[model samples]
Target: MRLDDLPLPDTPAARAALEVARRFHSPAFVNHGVRSYLWAAAAARSEGLAVDDELLFVSAALHDLGLEPAFDSHTLPFEEAGGLVAWVFAAGAGWTEERRDRAAAIIVAHMADAVDPAVDAEGYLLEIATALDISGRNPEAWDAEFRAEVLEAYPRLDLVGEFTGCIVDQAERKPGSTAAAAVAAGLPARLAANPLQL
Candidate 1:
């Protein structure tokens, strides 16, 4: 799917999520959030997965919020902390309790090695999208032209350096967290090797 063809939701909740991301994140992170959603939506279109666009967009926007000082958790992993933040945001947006839970679930699930699309399509898409954005995993899945469009719309900026510092800090603080696992698995090398670097 073309980047333009995947319409970004125009709902109040969607706008609010973008606002929150911009307020809390650096330009690199804000762009990462938006790009993650676009990549996921594009993949969903190609795979014929039925997804809630609002849910995916909101999840993508706030997935890394826990990395920010304002919302960073002392005890919980970053993703878990971010999930709680999403839950509260959904409540303020007047989403149902079930929907709020699902949003939070999607945020947390993005840290998983893999999420089954049949069970939680939004979560699965977010996982795949973030991996693509962060580590350049499966970049070839998206055509070159669409990738260029996405980068043009939301440039990568300094995501590699910014993300590395946040993730490394998370790994040091929470030794058992997914961030730690990723660090141990050579995330720095992967980030350096990411083909999306511009």
Candidate 2:
């Protein structure tokens, strides 16, 4: 789906985020990211959670908007920039302190090697989100074993699995304006090209 069609805030944070996306980014990341949000929305509804589709969508939008100038070149990740975008969103969108804190916590824990006890934070949500987006055909494929391993740590495996499969299936079919149809179209093949193994 087009970014415009996403439910994210149409405020400064959203505008600033689009400006950043225009600089340098991956179409695969964007497409799958949207696809992921769709699944997450489903999962949220299944839980009777009132996740702001727009808020979650905005969070997903800026999930990795901080890539290097070369788009995928740098290793450090635009961490500070990611925070800035989140800050902008919290302020511009008038989010509650709990919500802002949740986003900040999630972003901070996202890249950590170990899951913390304090939260069912962003890292966990993002894993579910990103997995829903890109866990293409053969999720049983060895290449994605690490993700499977990680999912094992979640309290909602069966639920995540349900929507994740849907994400892969949807990604395979072409329906609307994706970031680059060809990119996600090639994902299953690329994922199938190699299996993950520990």
> Considering every candidate listed, which one attains the maximal TM-score?
1
Residues 16-123 of candidate 2: C-alpha lDDT, one tens digit per residue: 555555444444445444444544554455445555555566666666554333322122334334645566567666878777766655554433434433345334
**Model 1 Cα lDDT, one tens digit per residue, 81-112:** 99999999999999999999999999999999
As for candidate 2, its clashing pairs are 106-122, 142-196, 143-195, 143-196
Task: Give the poorly placed runs of model 2, Cα more than 4 Å off.
Answer: 1-24, 70-81, 92-100, 109-123, 135-198
lDDT of 1 at 73: 97
For all predicted structures, in order, the TM-scores are 0.98, 0.47
The local distance difference test score of each candidate is: 0.95, 0.46
lDDT of 2: 0.46
lDDT of 2 at 62: 64
The CA root-mean-square deviation of candidate 1, after full C-alpha superposition on the true structure, stands at: 0.7
